[model samples]
Target: MANIKEHLLNTLEELATEDLKMFQWHLTNNVEDDKHIPKSRLEKADRHDTVDNMVQKYGQIGAVEITLDILKKMNNNQLAEELRTKVKNN
Candidate 1:
């Protein structure tokens, strides 16, 4: 298996437009804290904003690292696998 960072970064880019929007909303508003989407982050990411909000919302260093890792190695098969794994885990 690949290193955790490589695996995650290579996988993160698989998130669809809606998935990315939800992720941004969850991060900026702290879904655990807000329990609902934050419109600001949603709009920002939809408007093609930065990944900075993800770092701030997730706060767990591992999440950001993994996202970067996944985004780095995006591919159809990898994205499909990553999505399957993520959904199962969630």
Candidate 2:
């Protein structure tokens, strides 16, 4: 199984630029205040940086669940399900 970082990167790679922006926005805004990734930080992050930051802030499982939540908020249920399946299989 791929590591969590690789899984996150693979999932993020599926998004278009606009969708990625929306995903980041949701990520930044949807969490409890203490758990939020700063908009300033997310603004400059590429996929790798984004994944690293998420893992740093939330740990692997929390980061994956947060990503799933953001994806669902963006109406990307298919991607969320795909990511959940991948994580479960691993």
Candidate 3:
């Protein structure tokens, strides 16, 4: 089974640049308080950097949950389901 970080990276790697930006936008605006990621941090972050920051702030499972939630909110249900399935299978 892949580690949570690898799963996250793989999931993010699937995104196009614009979609990735939208994903980051949701991460910045949708979450509150401790779950919030600073715009400055996300401003220049790539997929790996974003995953690193998420893991740092929320740990592994928390990051995955947040990713799943944001993906769903973005109406990217296909990716969200893929992530859920991967996590479940692992």
Candidate 4:
């Protein structure tokens, strides 16, 4: 079985550039009970804008690492499995 870091990197590798950006947006925005994006910045915007914001706030590696950290902290099997499935599907 893959660990969190492995899972994230593998998923990152599998995703297309646009999909990866979307994933980054989801990491920073969606995901209930977990707010990675600041309250001030949560106002509606283009999803692509979120990708640019993530690039500024977290950079590529930082985005992946921060997301992995959040997912680990959440410790929800369903969420984790869903992410794994998304990774596989994409």
The candidate maximizing TM-score is 2
Estimated TM-score for each candidate: 0.37, 0.95, 0.94, 0.38
Q: What are the clashing pairs of model 4?
A: none
* lDDT (10s digit) by residue, model 1, range 10-55: 4444567766654454454543554333566457453223334443
Better of 1 and 3 by TM-score: 3
* Per-residue C-alpha lDDT of model 3 across residues 1-90, encoded as one tens digit per residue: 798899999999999999999999988888986689999999999999999989998899999999999998888899999998898888
TM-score of 4: 0.38
- Residue-level lDDT tens digits of model 2 in 1-90: 798778889999999989988888877988999999999999989888889989999999999999999998889999899889898889
lDDT per model vs. reference: 0.46, 0.90, 0.92, 0.53
Give lDDT for model 1: 0.46
Residue 9 CA error for candidate 4 (Å)? 13
Clashes of 4: 0
Clashes of each: 9, 0, 0, 0
